[model samples]
Target: VLSFGLAGAASQLLGDMAHRLIPVTDREAASLVRSIRTAPLLFGWRGSTPVDTPALEELLLRVSRLVDDHPEVVAVTLEPVVVAPHGVSVLGA
Candidate 1:
């Protein structure tokens, strides 16, 4: 089992929330990143439109690369993960 701990108790407190999960693999992850970076499909969800998905995906790619480069980070566990159709907001990152 993987256990995750939070720091900055008060400052980082997420205040309990819920989220929808989307399972993704390495290839799929890369593809999703690429699509968002290159396409405009991330717009128009609910009452929001043009959410700057490309920018968000680029950030996610950076995080992915950072994790891959750091060999010492054996496992990663983060929360408050937000995934929209065209973008993702990694609140815990």
Candidate 2:
């Protein structure tokens, strides 16, 4: 699942969301990332700077791998993730 909203927005109020089955392929991850309504923000809306979206896809892939490899793990939550021009950062996990 992927969702975006104003910073510090509640999970339920994210407004835009996308979801796909786990153990996602690279293609699926990329599709999932782009499927979000706010995806244009990552691709440089208007004259704004674009963020490292491929890095976000990679992060999703890594999270998928973690879940696929660890059956005991039920869920993962990464909050306040910062997506910058060069990379993505997880402020909380």
lDDT of 1 by residue, 3-26 (tens): 222233542365322211233334
Model 2 compared with the native: what TM-score?
A: 0.86
- Clashes found in each candidate (C-alpha, N, C closer than 3 A): 1, 0
Expressed as tens digits, the lDDT of each residue in 1-93 for candidate 2 is 333232534434666667877788999888887887677877889989999988988998888888888879887888878999999999999
Q: Using alpha carbons, what is the TM-score of model 1?
A: 0.40
Worst 10 residues of 1 by lDDT: 15-24
Which ten residues in a row are the worst by lDDT in model 2? 2-11
